[model samples]
Target: MKILQRKRKRIAAVLFTLTLMLCSCGQHAKTEQKHDWKAEAETASVYCVGKDDCFLCGTDAGYFGQNNIGIVSLNSFAVMPVEINRYDHNGQLIEENTGAMQMENFQNGENGMTVSVMLEPDRGIAHISISPNGDATLDLASAASHLCCDCLAELVSQLYGSVNGIGVVNFSTRRLYVLQEGVTSFGAGDYYVHCDYEALGGEIKILVIYSSLRYENLK
Candidate 1:
């Protein structure tokens, strides 16, 4: 009985030590994950194109002419594309072009700028500002009489159709009234549609930015 009791106590001691070591390891890992890279990296002023040749000073990412800038979280790599064109200033065409380009070495909280492009012959123009937090507001407003709302709707619809389970796609051409609100409303320039899909496991909200854009599967 005495020998058995001693063995049980020894086993208990070993178990206690193992538990403490595991707890310490867990705490160390948590501390490591809390590290912030932005606080450590040096800040350098850089310029990005903002609104038709206008440039803003920010961090230099060593690449130029990129249309899209995304900030990625270190822990999850969750990417948030910074507001490239918030104002829809020259309408969505400029925003579309801006979104077409890819960014490199761009970091969060970096001051950025964008250049506006004159793709159309019309002199009438507008601009909108989307905040870093995704709040958008129009800075300038002008009627684009020649804006093709139907075409824009078709483009978005076509891109959405390519996705599996997206059905009965409907397009609407409406002039956007609220510059800050992201939703596409009735207008002659901006058009948007509500789409529903049967997703596996549950319903998912898929905001199809560009209809007819297909993603390639990278193995």
Candidate 2:
């Protein structure tokens, strides 16, 4: 009877140890699952392809007045010449002032760099400023032609110029002001051009004046 009792006690001890080990393993698994859940929730759906592409992400990401500037896709990022002078001081051709867009690291989904472009018309000048916030603004020429009163006034109301309202101006006589808004997947700025021409009997003569500005932001 004494030997039997000893054997029973040993069996009980072994079973208890097995139970403890199983419980410990279960607890560890639960902890690991919790950690994985948190990681999945914080991960981003998209990623930058490279530094240059990253800079195109932040251009015109916000809503300004009536218009919203934003990147169409990650593929739009590319290196283009950066125009240093608003007016080609050396009488250089407009195409000669081109600059390249250099890509950099991603900054919280914002492009690490910024760019600016200016547009000047013969009768007036406009300033288009873009930032990483995707914010854009069009400061119109204070003394533009009265013919553009309604059109110009509407454009100033919003950062992204309204394509519909601008269509009212006679394209031939009315100088078309164009400002490229953003760069690549993340970049921001405005494209502005000033037209100094008049429509006479359906004929348009554009006066090539130094009234346009184009620039870039290296932030």
Global Cα RMSD, each model: 18.9, 22.5
Relative to the true structure, how large is the alpha-carbon lDDT of every model?
A: 0.28, 0.29
Per-residue accuracy of model 1 over 1-219 as CA lDDT, tens digit each: 999999999999999999999999999888765543233211111211222332112223221223323222211222343333333434243433332343323222342222122211121222212122211111111111111333222222322111211111111211112211123322222212222223343332222222222576789
TM-score of each: 0.25, 0.21
lDDT of 1: 0.28
Error of 2 at 190 (Å): 34
The candidate 2 region of ten consecutive residues with least summed lDDT is 163-172
Tens-digit lDDT string for candidate 2 (154-177) = 323332311111111111122223
On the 0 to 100 scale, the lDDT of residue 128 in model 2 is: 27
Best by TM-score: 1
Superposed Cα deviation of residue 138, candidate 2 (Å):
44
